[model samples]
Target: MAGPDLTLDQARQQANLAFTASGTEFAFGDAAALPLPIAQMKALSAGSPGVETLHDGGLTAEVLCLKHAGRRWAVKRARPVCRVRNIEGQTSFLNELQRHAELAGLRLPGVIRPVYGSLRDGLVVSPWISGRHPGVLDERQARTLLETGCALIEHGFFEWDYSAGNLLDDGERIWLYDFGYCYRFDPLTQFNSAGHGCEHPRHHLAERIEGRHLFGALLDAGNDDEALPHFIRFKRLAAQAYVDLADRLARRGATPPVLGHYRGLAARWHQELAHAPGLLYLASAWQAHSSDLDDDLRGRSCTPRTLQRAQWLQATLGAQGHRLRRSGALSPDDAALDDTALLRRYHDREVEARRCQL
Candidate 1:
């Protein structure tokens, strides 16, 4: 195996690159290799013929698709100003530039690497992946995404946002192209890149997929009968993936707590999948939806799906607050609220979510 593209030391040094008044130039390999010259790439505009503008609800950059040398390429330009008001939003472009280099080096499958990028020029170029954002996930698509995500975790890259826009399916395989929100963490010791790394165990790989994408797809299901089968399939896959992840991390000398974490989850999921899968689904659904809603609210980038998620929470709280509480799905504060109080709280959140639409 060639191993990953950059060593930890090299990745750290690259991350510290500073932008001067003249702007820092960055590239994965040969910037001269692009079909278009750097000057022409920097001057690309949406109005130009043969350019197809893509507004994928991205907050930090504008994406344009065009043909070059008989092939399609996606040219992403950083927005003059990012839409989200947070610090992470402000610096995401530079962060992505850094990730682009590291991921290019790793050369992981299904992860599209940029041919060239320049932070100073606020540009990145990659072959345009030929796929659409799946409105719903079949078993094959779900397993493909899960396998790809697991591979990333094993390599210490934690991808936070697996939203619909960040994914594509070119008939045969799913592709992950964006790296703006992907960050490095110690796979042997930490659960994720969130607060103090291991402090947030709820932000694991399955939670992210379930919260950001799967549950959203389930929201359109007519009833539990329709959604239950899909959730079951995913949970089965996740349990096995956790088992494999735990084994790999253990061989790498992961700490006891980290190993125990994955093993415990696998055990519990297996137990639940055999006996009380409904409770498992309910608990995971509550956590995933609530967490994702909070993320959007904090980032001030809520969308129509955000509103729907808020509504789902409110409705679920009304109909199954008791079940959620019994299933240990509710947090301490949420567990304390009565049904009416919980309903009212989520209703307020729904209104706020609508106000924050990007």
Candidate 2:
């Protein structure tokens, strides 16, 4: 939606005007009962500034905690120069402001409520949610996240990022906040916003949860004796979530291809659960965790979990090369290699990955 004539700053200013004209709720100047205008939130204090500043908040903006008058709010300020540099990255802050305009009134329990936002001011405000990222997800959390993802899908919003940094669990429920990567898509007749959501059936709600959050934690868990049981538990929950998602989407008049996508996913997991469940888990965990790790490294956003996953992959390739090969997680060339060769290959990659470790 940005243009060459319009600088990023100009584009942002335009976005703010567009949203304001549409009557989105905005709090400022002692009207909405805030301690400060959204723009001034970044300077809440000298060094504190009340910024949450999540490491995984992506490269476009700085997320800060804002405490005003007796209440706390999250005031995300767009960096003067976005770190991402790509068109999507360059325009993400504006995108989030626009998305907030659409979501400001939707009282979805799983979705975070947007209080106010302004691209001109380079900030958006929302209530601050507090909770730990329960490294391991239980059924309740998994169900909540997947169901909310499905709701977003049904409503034509396709969210691309589901990283741990974008979510919070308040013990009772999992809350999704960031909308920087969220885009529009057709839910009934087409795939996600990319093409038709059906073309890449692999990018499901459950898949996002596993790749973004669950698999990384399993690395922290260590060893198959422990990780396998944890995965099996989640797989069972995922299977059910898929069933419920498919049913809900079906009633919403989702197209056959779309419905088939969800149902097929459920059937595969259910079928595998009845038979080759562990094999399924091993292959999935390896692919999900490994791919997610590669993503972090590519983004130069390595976390403690990223380093742990690299170590785990190296050890697993060394200890169970045959099983990993059979799981089809490694590349075909690597899989065809002997145990010693495969282990060495992974070890070298692990070493490179560690170089960027934080």
Candidate 3:
């Protein structure tokens, strides 16, 4: 059967109206009335046996835990008014459901299976992932998680919301949940000249570092000093990766948005490295606590001090070129300074250091 036909905005309005009309406090019960097949409703109830009324968190939407077909699932409904400017989350969630349904049997978590209705006020039911939110893992665990995450990203499983709270660790293994904002990262198709095709670069970088640092802190048992270095290295590596990806896109004649994101990230990293040298050093020192040192050490061995210096040099080169571009006074010699070359050198040096240390 075809799914509900409604724009995210329409869905949001319908959800809000349903919430108000039902007077059920939580919109879950009311949302259920948004026209679903009787059989599907019965199946949902059967799947989530113990669900009845659920809690409501006042945000863009209301979420409810329900029992359908003897299984428990989360039902999220959008509000009536479009308070949030970007409908990315709503769109991404709908996309995940569609994509995951097509690629069933993958190890990844289930999407909004049986989508039962439309994007707005829709009922998405996936098995609840069990375990506490993932934090920094010990050296062994961190390596495992990082490799796993990288592999996932490479496979086009880019979860825009990779926060610690979104990850659940069941002691034996880690399962990613809350994939409402996940997207397929297509290097070729998903680039523009203004910025990357995905979310803002700063938001992406901040979320990535926050997740990595949380992992680092967990590995160090909440010792900020010990986790500092890992945070620095993770940030640098992430920024480098972003810049490299942007360069590749630029070479393909991608839009300025794509290049802009990379440039922004590179500039940010350079600024941080120059002004907050101590922070980077502290982050590197904390790398000792990463569970993934073996993977890091498998490449070049970079001292905290060296990484900082290299980052500063690269940033300076980039800033000079940017200034020239803005002022329309870029000399051939100044333009000759290869930003990509400097970035590669820093990347290789850091990888080598990490490998050696491991």
Best by TM-score: 1
Off by over 4 Å in 3: 1-49, 52-55, 58-63, 66-72, 75-85, 89-96, 102-106, 109-121, 139-144, 187-223, 226-358
Local accuracy of candidate 3 as per-residue lDDT tens digits, 1-358: 2235553334544554454456533211233433345345334432354556553533344445665465555554444543334454324444544444433435433222333324444444445544666555444334444544544443445555454545566675565545555555554444211133444333343345353345434343544456556556655655666666567666777667656766686776667676874444443332322212222343233235334433433453454434324432233443454667545654565556544431
Cα deviation of 80, candidate 2, in Å = 1.0
**What are the C-alpha RMSDs, in order, of all predicted structures?**
4.7, 5.4, 15.1
lDDT of 2 by residue, 1-358 (tens): 7676654345555665566457555432221544475435645433564543543345777766666566777667778788876656666877776666776666666888756676666766678888766677777787777778877876777777877778888888888889998876677776666533445666666777788878877767866678777788788877887678778778888788878877787798888778987778877877786777778778766777776777777776766667777776676776677787766766676677778765
Candidate with top lDDT is 1
| Local error of candidate 3 at residue 163 (angstroms) | 1.7
Judge candidate 1 against the unseen true structure and give its global Cα lDDT, from 0 to 1: 0.82
For model 1, the stretches where C-alpha displacement exceeds 4 angstroms are 1-23
Q: Which lDDT values do the candidates have, in the order given?
A: 0.82, 0.71, 0.46
Q: Where does candidate 2 clash, by residue pair? A: 50-65, 51-64, 51-65, 52-65, 191-196, 191-197, 191-198, 192-197
**Residue range 1-358, candidate 1, lDDT tens digits:** 2235654334443445334233656656567878778888878887776677665457789888977768888989998888866656666887788788888888776788888888778888999988888655787887788788988988889998887888899987789988888888889988887655777887888888888888998888766668888999988988898999899999999999899988999899999999999999999989988988988898787888899889888878878878888899988898887888888888988899999888
Candidate 3 lDDT score relative to the true structure: 0.46
